[model samples]
Target: MLERLQAALDNNDAQGFSRELGNIAKLRSMAQLAKDTGLGRESLYKALSGEGNPSFGTILKVIHALGLKLNVQLPERTV
Candidate 1:
């Protein structure tokens, strides 16, 4: 799952990543996810629906709610 998300990120496919997250969240129950993330259920649905452009904070919250973390890495090339 992480790999798939990473692939979407690497490919610059924001919608794909959001859609995948939405699918996972739905599987875990949107109500539960909303409670866990402290976000409104409808907002979560809109953000992760692959149509809405969610904020970064929202993305982080959803990722954490899904028991995932977004790791940062330096580019391999050195300046």
Candidate 2:
């Protein structure tokens, strides 16, 4: 799931990222995820529903709460 989220982010696919987040939220209740991330449950739902624009900070918090971490990698170059 984390890998899928990272792929979405790397591809700059907002909807895909949101979907991955939604999946994660389903595994762990949104209310609990919200409490863990220090965000409002409804707000978190909106953000992960692909309908809300969440800030980078919010994304970071949510990722952390999910026990995931984001890493940077150089894009592969085609020969």
Candidate 3:
């Protein structure tokens, strides 16, 4: 699921990506995401808006808040 979400985000498919993130955030109140992420509600709103730019840490917290984990992977090499 996370992989699919990441693919959507990487592709800049706003609708799909936003839907995924929104579902996760929906688990908690916007205020809760704000408090837990240490970002203001307004900031959180912007960061998750699909057009907003946020630090990697902020993105991580939002993912964590949504019970998701980010895994780092090396890119495949061309032969």
Candidate 4:
């Protein structure tokens, strides 16, 4: 599931990423996630539906709720 999400991201597929995210969210307990993220379950669904543009903060909350870490490794710049 996570791999699928990463693949979507690697491909720069926003809608696919959102769909994958929605799938992952469905696998977990939405009530728990809502409580953890302090977001409504319905709202989570809408945001992760690949239609709505969710805020960065909301994405962060969802990622955190899923117990995943996002690491950033920028490529070295060529002078």
Candidate 2: list runs displaced more than 4 Å: 76-79
lDDT of 2 by residue, 1-79 (tens): 8788878888999878987987898698888888898899988888887778878788888888888777887879999
Runs with alpha carbons beyond 4 Å of true place in candidate 4: 76-79
Pairs in clash, predicted candidate 2: none
Runs in model 1 deviating more than 4 A are none
- Candidate 3 residues 1-79, lDDT tens each? 5665887877877556665675567657888887777778887777666667666677788878766776777879999
**Model 3 Cα displacement at 13 (Å)?**
6.5
How do all models score by TM-score? 0.86, 0.81, 0.65, 0.86
The CA lDDT at 63 in model 1 is 89
Quality of model 3 by C-alpha lDDT: 0.72
Candidate closer to the true structure by TM-score (higher is better), 2 or 3? 2
Of candidates 4 and 1, the better by lDDT: 1
**Which candidate ranks first by lDDT, i.e. highest?**
1
C-alpha RMSD (angstroms) for model 3: 3.3
